[model samples]
Target: MRSDTLDERSAVKLLLWLLLFVLCWPLALLALLLWPVVWLLSLPFRLIGISVEAVFALLRAVLFLPARLLGHKDA
Candidate 1:
């Protein structure tokens, strides 16, 4: 389930990047060139986002423990 969500997210990002690239190749090329630097600059925020996601996932699992133990399948 988590893998599916990750795959979907990656696909969406790729599609959007492709759309931008098609619309303006020069700008896209510049973005491609700058991606590594931008990503490095944003690394801290990305880490925070991942941490928050993990916390929420853990909270959800705790909240759903009873239903899971009773064999109530998630829809």
Candidate 2:
């Protein structure tokens, strides 16, 4: 079966979390509470990464512009 779909992935995640809850409810609760805080803390770093990626893409396009103008096609 195709288990790569979003619904299947979510089901798998829920099952794993349920197992964790059954084994150690306290740790599961801690993870649930801290997940949002950790994501928030990393937001700035994510934005910086996106900005750097954009800059690199722009640089690559600039570097390739002359080749594109000279009728060079991507191989």
Candidate 3:
């Protein structure tokens, strides 16, 4: 009885592992194939995000210029 339980558990584990591999392989392959394309497509959005970040940074610098010139260094 003990041996049978152990064998069953191992078989179930193997089956689950196999199922996971089979299910995931196609997705992995698809991602691998499309990663560059997806990245290319998202380049514009990434550029926009960077531009917005830069704009905000410049705005902050301009807004704080007076305080900085007055020697009010933020601790």
Candidate 4:
């Protein structure tokens, strides 16, 4: 079900890009060409974001450990 939503979103994005291509081929071509370089440049930032998220999760779990031990349920 989630995959279907993602596919639909991809389809919509593609359609929007096609419309851009039809309106201004040069800009669309430039975007298509630069997208890979942009994604590659952003990869490290994405990794950092994931690492930060994991750290926050660990902190949350550690903080909640005493409550959990006392038979408190997570809300």
* Most TM-score-accurate candidate: 4
Best by lDDT: 4
Checking candidate 2 for backbone clashes, the offending pairs are none
lDDT of 4 by residue, 1-75 (tens): 699999999999999999999999999999999999999999999999999999999999999999999999867
- How much is the lDDT of residue 13 in candidate 2? 92
Q: Report residue 7 deviation for candidate 1 (angstroms).
A: 15
Q: Kindly give the stretch of ten consecutive residues in candidate 3 with the minimal lDDT sum.
A: 26-35
RMSD for each of the candidates: 6.0, 2.8, 13.4, 1.1
Give the winner by lDDT: 1 or 3.
1
Q: In angstroms, give how far residue 27 of model 2 lies from its true place.
A: 0.2
Q: Could you give candidate 1's per-residue lDDT for residues 1-75 as a string of tens digits? A: 699999999999999889999999899889889999998999999999999999999999999999999999989
TM-score of 2: 0.88
The lDDT, on a scale of 0 to 1, for candidate 2 is 0.96
**Model 3, 1-75: lDDT tens per residue?**
599999999999778666755889776667667879999999999999999999999999999999999999897
Indicate whether candidate 1 or candidate 4 has the larger TM-score.
4
Model 3 scores a C-alpha lDDT of 0.87
Candidate 3 residues lying further than 4 Å off, grouped into runs, are: 1-22
The lDDT-based order of candidates, best leading, equals 4, 2, 1, 3
Q: lDDT at 71 for candidate 3? A: 94
- Model 2 lDDT tens row, 2-67: 657978889999999999999999999999999999999999999999999999999999999999
